[model samples]
Target chain A: MQTTQRPAVSEAVAKSRKKRELIKNVVAYSFIAPNFVGFAVFTLVPMVMAVALAFLSWDGSTNNPITFVGIQNFIDLFQDAKFRQALINTVAYAVITVPLTMAASLGLAILLNQQIRARNFFRTMMFFPYVASMVAVTAVWNMLFNPAMGPVNMILSGLGVENLPRWSVDNNWFICMGTVILFSIWKFMGYYMIIYLAGLQGVNPDLYEAAALDGASPWQRFWYVTLPQLRPTTFFVTVMLTIQCFKVYDIFLMITNFGPGGKTRVLVGNIYEAAFTSRKFGYSSAIAMVLFVLVLIVTLVQFRGEKSMNE
Target chain B: MKEKSGITGGRIAVYVILILLSVLTIIPFAWMLSASLKLNKDVFAWPMEWIPSNPQWANYINIWTKIPLLKYIGNTAILTVVVTLLQLLTSSFAAYAFAKLRFWGRNLLFLGYIATIAMPWQVYMVPQFMMMSGMGLNDKLIAMVCLQAFSAFGVFLMKQFYDGIPDELCEAARIDGLSEYGIWAKIMLPLSKPSLATLTIFTFVNTWNDFLGPLLYLHTDSKKTLQLGLRMFIGQYSAEYGLIMAASVVALIPVLIVFLALQKYFVQGIASSGLKG
Candidate 1:
């Protein structure tokens, strides 16, 4: 709104309004100060520093002075075999886990959406793994997947399977990566299932009735009505899962710890290993920059997709 | 009659499949519990003893003795409570400003929060660790508390809920000469209970389960949380599967109780805000 200083009385009213606006601003800032201050210190500053640190050389020690080495870390990172492998592993884990989690969660949501007995019980049970601590959850799975003596192999042997793939102990990358992906799917699918259940509920029942009236079968109704209605939810889930998969460290740490020769090491695990274990702050920040850019691109795409959908 | 009977059969079949899937979902945790009770050798006995003839009640006792499990739990509890309480207060307070108050740069500031929420902490954890270490907060539980005390996601979640609140309520409260803080405290806070519960659950669960934060910040044995403690226990006593499972069970009970008690909030919160811990 444009303020016109037409005359003395009008000028006085505008001045008072401006004063009120100032008071409001002060009050708002007072409310926001506490969280914003902590946020700025802990999260915002570190984020900026991370970007800056990526272009510098620092061993994260007091003796070594930080030096500007623009793009050198990136050059070194690209040529590093461990970084390359971690990048591939991270991408592979995300690529495999995201779609599978989405599908399984969607299917589970559809199943639970039916007017069945003890719906909440089933929902709670499914979502239980997500709430459980990753350390505990992975510990249990480690025992279950313990190749030489775990129940998984024991059951497999009982089912007339001669060759067990030696679950986590196997040197094969596929076995390790596959187990990680499967665990990822199980742990996360329930959370997505809840989101999808919400989406499924928002779907108009009238659409199903209309489809049925038009001679559509159950699968057809689901394919034609349910899937389309869930596009936004699915989009949200995919973006969340993608972002999550990239940051997956706890599961890998507990289950594999980049072991069996770093076959299952992820981007975050690499960043951790580099920064903490190797004390290569600059190189690690460079790796972090790659993660940041990947997530930023996904987020930008999400915003764009959301805007288009809203339009 | 035929169609009706077929519908019954279909319903029964769906029920059966759901029951089976539920069992499949629970098998791992059930196995954990079962293994926690069993002797290590019997835990993986052929055909898998679903129930041990004699439960190893001693393994549970050994966990507390072998490692400082109680201290880890105490550390985790303190951190979780403090972080959750602080997050709720600050995030809700900040959210009220973002949602209800008209101010310069309000939209831009809220956008900052949204942007950070999308950026995973892994991207900046190294710098964060460096900053904390530079401040002489290394190997301190206070560092983890400070790091997690403020959250963009919590603010975003609360703001979304607050945005739904009728402006007229605040206006009426203002007419009654209630200060903005009073309006937030007496009105907004009370009204945003569901969101508060949601944030509490997320913060509590996340803090309790957090591994990397403790792994990075809290290096001392005395300050380690349950996740770090359990991991260390595993590394040290890799052969003692029974004790490990027992400790894992102890670690899981708090979260399981929290989840089961207030699970509706989990679904409602996620459905409304689409945020997760």
Candidate 2:
């Protein structure tokens, strides 16, 4: 802002604004240099490398012959039973969890936005699960879902609901979805609720005041005014959540770790097993490519949706 | 007067529900705390013991002796601090450039930054592993440290904060002879403290909780992060409830403290940034 004095700030500093612009350009490049380089190597470049590796057949072993087997690995995924299970579970996981998670967070944000006493206390309580190491927190969740000693089954029995479906039990499709969905909500509701709360607060109270003058009931005001005003925030949230649910690994890896006949398995889980367990780096890259393609499609749809809304 | 009383009644209902829901949310940890203090067998008694029989505080001490609890704590603290400092510096500079100092490729690069969000880290893990392995930095903490040191998400947040500072304030500084970098470090940064504090807290919390990067990169126990260090406690000598809970509780304190202390900024930061499309 003080650039005006620079009309004569220094002997070397004098010149047209273009000269000054060039100086600023160099400075800005230095500032963002590390980040662009990091993104290129770790993100952009590795992705391209992964794409190239997809067609190569090698087990990452010294003696294994490498061959360019175009379309073979992609074809293999169609017949791979484990890959099918992982794909199905990933789809089911997102379908069940994302909507439920968003709804719960939105509800909690509304409740918390009210003039409740000890609001900060409630906020902290809700956000506690989100602040810990996922492994540690999921270990607790693991015990909670344990068939033998977990509190869930214990609570079920206390209510005389005997013969409860075993959570974390192998091949129990319903229970796998249930446990992962519950854990996913508990893990993230705080963070998202915080986001929703901000959105709720951003909504001008003037609208509420106007509705009150018109004799609108609280529920009517909320449904008519608050909900419509929060659409933009909701759209941003939906996009972010969709991407996150797709990439979810830490919690999935920790709780059940693709458990019980691989019923809870996800694409990332399959990739981990392929690369680390089987030492098939090329195959893992192919799985990653599939995941990349899926995410690309999902994000592009959201971008298109956003553009249509803007228009 | 009837309407006033009805409003009062509704407020009371809200309070009761909020408190009840809060308890349901927090009860698991309370149960964890209770179980952590109980003797091994007391954990599974059918009727259940809500509190520990003896309140064995030594469970906290036992985790230290039985597991590498102290080493894990040290590793987590160092990693959290180092990464937070680096991200704040790198992010702030880039964000300032994006927010105020315009140049060529600026808008395009920002779009590229936003686009990185969709390419989940797994898509690049194989290639990242290749590069780090090539550099011989795989086993070292550098692998984890460098991966996170400059983040696109961090830049996204910092740029938002910078956008809020009036351009006139910056122009005034420029008229007074401040360099673009100097204006950022001086006028802009001090004004952007609230957002910087939020970024600092999140970077620390996320880094501390991060399990994937440390899991992928660090192999040796001595070099292990707290998350990896904590993973060791689960299976060793059966699932001892007391020791594991002790370690888990201890592990949560730092992040919890960090969150509580700077909470106002964290909430405000998210609120501002969460402003939608």
Candidate 3:
């Protein structure tokens, strides 16, 4: 009788444990439901719709239905001159802005990491532009870049320079692009400097002492010891800056208003115009798809690089 | 004595360079403030008045009168507060499930969510705009609030914070017969104040400075946020540098205050998330 009761009691315990596990699952699901549902409705669904809409021709009007035209939108995008220009402009912006900003911020970080006075104040001053709104920053920059009456040109002309290009108004793409790049560097350098500062903290002081004992000059120490140690941080900054550079819309929109006849038009600006201004939903999605692919490739490369670095 | 002199010289050079750069960094803001107080005609004066002789304090007042500055500020405030609170609640709840709960497809769901961060908004901008308009939510602050409230980045941030916490506490609480929601509210939320504060600072600053989101969603003049209002203000009063600078300065105050007050958390939040990425 005792042996029979033991098996029955064990069975009852297992069943109760199963019931508890089921209840726990329900509670977990309930905790996740609210956020997950909102994310699905807003982000996940829209992403899927974007991919689908890229292949269809739609005017975004309810009177017309989305018609599937495979590969045509992509083909047309390649053939479009404006799209080509935008792609080139965006690449140029990233190419110029990324390395310059990185070098500038890394330089600032190295200086601040020294036994300097008023370090915190310097850091705050550098970061102030980043904290300010893009609209406000660009507004100030726009006035500074004002062709005739702006202080920037005034300073140049005061210094007896010949023929100041109308800064942002210059039809020459290079000058306009340069203005945008300058503003981008000014706006973002502080934020990147903070990242480098954090990276600097992780470097062991003993390594510096060892280098000093080996009769390394400050320049050599930076070149040999500091730069190598900052590889991971540099890589992270490069990836982030690259991604951000590709999505450079707000500055262009506010600073130059597409820069004196679309000379500085970027991929995002193109996509904005196509979708909202021109009402070509399908075509705009195709441009966005190209952007999506470019970003995806960059991100995947970074991940692969990170994995190999880890190995 | 030679080494000491060399070190002193190097230090002096560093200070000079730093001071110079700091001046360059600050001059734009200084110029903005100075120009905001100057007469419209004096704004472009060459050797530009670093200091306005007669500060036009009325430019500040004029900006208020020219546009519905108060209305825009109110709109921005409402969106920032609502969105920040909702994001914290939703992100923390989802983060608790991801960090503490046992579930199927958890890792897969999280990967899907995090992957969205890599995609720029341009990818889904049109579709999301269409979705919002279809629901007749376009031009409404609540729509913007709802759209921004569930950030995958916020979830990822909170989850990283939650991952630092030991499971022993949650297990102990469970043994004490506390429900999962009770554990989340009473145990997890209380302990994760630092992460919450970091997320709050980031969300508030991002929302306050946001231009594209407001530009896309809120079309009506009365519904515009501060960023959008400033943009339109520039377009209309492009010639009025004094008023523009004053408006810009006014628009920048809240973010500046937040940054100054919470400098440590703000910098830490940026560094940690950035390095992790």
Checking candidate 3 for backbone clashes, the offending pairs are none
DockQ values per model: 0.76, 0.64, 0.78
Query: What lDDT tens digits, residue by residue, belong to model 3 across residues A1-311?
Result: 99999999999999999898888788888888889998999999989988998899988899999899998999999999999989999999999999999999999999999988899999999998888899988888988889888888888888898899787889888898899999999999999999999999889899999999999999999999999999999999998898899988998888777868777889999989999999999899999988888899889988998998899
What TM-score does each of the candidates earn? 0.97, 0.92, 0.97
Tens digits of per-residue lDDT for model 2 on B1-277? 9999998999998888888888878877887787788777776667777876688898877888887777877877887788889889888888888888878999999998888765788787866886788788877877887877777888899888788788999899889998887897888788888989989988988888887788888898878888888876675654687677777788778887888899888888777776643
Q: Which ranges in model 1 have alpha carbons more than 4 Å from their true place?
A: A1-17, B275-277
* Model 3 chain A worst lDDT window (10 residues): A254-263
> Looking at candidate 2, what is the lDDT of residue A82?
91
- Model 3's TM-score against the true structure: 0.97
The runs of at least 3 residues in candidate 3 whose Cα sits more than 4 Å from the true structure, single-residue gaps closed, are: A1-14
Q: Could you give me the TM-score of model 1 versus the true structure?
A: 0.97
Query: In model 2 chain B, where is the ten-residue run with the lowest total lDDT?
Result: B230-239
lDDT of 1 by residue, B55-122 (tens): 89999998898999999999999999999999999999999999899899998888889879989988
> Who is ahead in TM-score, 1 or 2?
1
